[model samples]
Target: MTSTPPLRQQCPPGACDCHRERLLENPDADLRILLLTRNEEQRLLERLENLKDLADLQRMQQKLQEQLGIRLHIAPGFNEVRTTRGIEFDFEDQPGLCRKTRQAIPAAIRRSMEKNPEIAWRLLDSHDLLGGL
Candidate 1:
């Protein structure tokens, strides 16, 4: 007497629901994060950083527009456009921090001063920025 093979072996490739059964057997098997490689994790972190930067730039643009009474847009790669009372102008956003303002800012911390008083302030304040100070 010959015994029957397993159900999967008995059926042709597309004739069985074995694939669905395997998935239903383990629900979390479909989660991509569980299979992420080191490179994938790094890429995800970089993408998050880029998203944060874009959000910061947009917030700065909004504040500048309110302060200057203009319609302002800050685009990527050093480009800015402002429209005031129907007059529009474009400008390149170059780093304009004075040499003194670019110095070690420990004194600023001691004084509890958060604003830069010359250019932009820190978007995110964290211990990492202090470099273990």
Candidate 2:
């Protein structure tokens, strides 16, 4: 006996489903932008400074996701990875450094990390960045 494949929803014949499908394809499109003002940067750094352990950092990551819709990954001791739409905090070797992959990071984040190397170092240590990735 032959099994049938799962049925898929079909768009109406005359309707243009391209737009709808595109939107559905990338629901996180809106979350692609990471914008933070200087004051906002200061506030975020202050919060990061207060974190006590990996668990606290994880909670902060969740808060960041909920508030800013950005995904934060903390990989200790790994070289920073950046993308056109993503910013990686490089605290492995040099703290408070913003390195880009294809495009430049947002101005605010760049300034924040550049200005607060010690805080960035603290963040790395909190996440055990020095130990391993």
Candidate 3:
């Protein structure tokens, strides 16, 4: 007799229903905190440390719920964007924190700029102002 795969194992529970619900939901209804930065190795560790703080997490959670009308969760993960000189940091959980961190990128860049004045000035000069606009 040939062995057959279990149905439950083959098709997990809530797969169809949950995916359907998520599809029906608004695209922007879910909040995504993306961290786009250059020279990630220098700042990744420090940024992760800041994110692990309790006060920062709480504040971020509150902001997501209040501003985006979506519940937030925080997970630790990062991705590299192709064709770009930067890394995109992604938080699966604590989206609020991610959003806040995204906002703080400029400040962080400024701080880094102070330390490496030469590279900072070069970056500032080379950045495309019109691209963002």
Candidate 4:
């Protein structure tokens, strides 16, 4: 008998990469962004500074998701796609499909820090860029 295909589609490129990296780097941990929102930049920084083990982070993430009814999905192709009409914070990273998706945002951020600080932090963290810190 032939097997049926899975109901869900393959995750976008960067989504899997991010999730894989997180797992490989910390087998049971999650990231801080999963618990915070754009308006909570200060809180996010604080959490990042005090970030502990993976299990702790996982608990924090779970609590935040439960409390806020939101969850952070780490998959390969699912990146925060930015386009002419504002950024789709959860858009998948598809080549040629989203020209502005997953592209650099540091310079744009530097040009106007106040306008994109929170989003910039999210993107910067995702790219594993801590150089400016």
Which is the leading candidate under TM-score?
2
Rank by TM-score (best first): 2, 4, 3, 1
Q: Which stretches of candidate 3 lie over 4 Å from their true place?
A: 1-24, 27-99, 127-133
Model 1 segments more than 4 A misplaced: 1-28, 52-133
| Candidate 3 residue-wise lDDT at 84 | 19
In model 4, how large is the Cα lDDT of residue 14? 62
Model 1, range 1-133, lDDT digits (tens) per residue?
Answer: 9983222122245544324345435755432212223344344334323333334444544643443222333221222212111212233221221122112122222122222211112222121332444
Task: Write down the RMSD of all candidates, one decimal each.
Answer: 23.1, 14.4, 16.8, 14.9
TM-score of each: 0.20, 0.36, 0.26, 0.26
- Residue-pair clashes per prediction, in order, are 0, 0, 5, 12
lDDT of 1 at 48: 26
Task: Encode model 2's per-residue lDDT on 1-133: one tens digit a residue.
Answer: 9984332233355542223244336755442222343355457766665555445556766776676554555443345523212335432221112232111223334344455544356556566654653
Kindly indicate the candidate among 2 and 4 with the higher lDDT.
2
Error of 4 at 59 (Å): 1.1
Off by over 4 Å in 2: 1-35, 78-133
Q: Provide the overall lDDT of each model, using Cα atoms, as 2-decimal numbers.
A: 0.29, 0.43, 0.37, 0.37
> Candidate 3's residue-wise lDDT over 13-121, tens digit each?
4332223234325576343322222233235435533443334444645764564333544322234322112322233343223333443443443344345554333
